[model samples]
Target: MDQHAQRHGARAARSHGTVEPEHGATTAARHPELAPGTSGMKGRARHIPATVSLPIITALAFGCFIIFRTHTAGIKGGPAMLYGLAGAVVSGALGLVVAHFQSTLITETRASAYGALFGCSLGWVYSLGGEAILKSCAFGFTMGAVMFVAALYVFRTHRTREPHGLHRPHKTHHRDDRSHRLPAATH
Candidate 1:
């Protein structure tokens, strides 16, 4: 087909349900049973890859931390694995929850909440490893605060890139009413 015709055909196909080959399969095809535009207010949340990745990353990081910390503290193998696994599961679960429901909360609040959750999970894990309560709390709070600041920046940038909400003003067509009016009354 000629370039113009091919371009037109692609556009026409996109306007309908069928996706162009270069564009890849539709999201519904990949996810199955998830129709587009059906996710409601949190529709965009599913698109954010961090929802899945952050949890996995956090879990792995926790496992690593446990390994290093235990080794340095002279703790043995099985107990180190136990601590690591516990921290991984807890942090991962919290990360998943934050990533999934993040879109529903106010941007700043979501960041702070997620940070706090992350910090608390870490703090709890640290305490389980025999750290002092005061030290754990202080470390957790510091980590949480750092996360909060970082997340706030990231989320703000993300929000700006993708516009949302029902606050946009509608455009109305102004038509001249004089043409439809009756003749002015003459006494």
Candidate 2:
């Protein structure tokens, strides 16, 4: 067949959802692990290292912010360093705990977990500014509630398609509408 005809045929096949497989490669040749009757591995493998690294990254960012803020508040260099390191460790541990179990949770629970995490972290950092404990806690609680509400809204909106009842009914064309007809053929 000519190249143009072959290209047209291939395009038509793709539009119909079936593609001719490559001639020289057998299934076994492409993936040896799935040979004949063998069952490969079951279930999805957890990516342990990747999962663990997220919390470490979060901790580093949190610690850097704390260190910078403390130094700006006139803390001595050694004390500022200590505070940053300690904050990093604590945040990292909390992040690790959250990461481990987040996937198994329902949507609402997961949102609440993230909201609490953010609120508590921010509140701790706020306390470093010499705010009273009660003030810090209150600030954290307010921020957390806001986060929870926002997260809930996002999750609910994105997960589902709009209901049929919510959609405007499509307009139908009427054969009797003379305006839509072509002008009578001119002589």
Can you give the TM-score per candidate against the true fold? 0.58, 0.55
State the lDDT of candidate 1 residue by residue for 1-187, as single tens digits. 3487677664436365565645665676566437665655355666658669778887889778977787667788888888788778777787788777866777677889878986887677567667899999998898889989998787676655423432233755456656656798999
Cα lDDT tens digits, model 2, 1-187, are 4487577664324445444446333465566555676455411122336558888988999899999988887787999989999999998998888778865666688679878987998888888888899998999898888888897676566555322222234777898887877899988
Scored by lDDT, model 1 comes in at 0.73
**Model 1, which residues run further than 4 Å from truth?**
1-49, 125-130, 161-187
Best by lDDT: 2
lDDT of model 1 at position 28: 60
Considering every candidate listed, which one attains the maximal TM-score?
1
lDDT of 2 at 181: 75
**lDDT for each candidate structure:** 0.73, 0.75
* Residue-pair clash count for candidate 2: 0
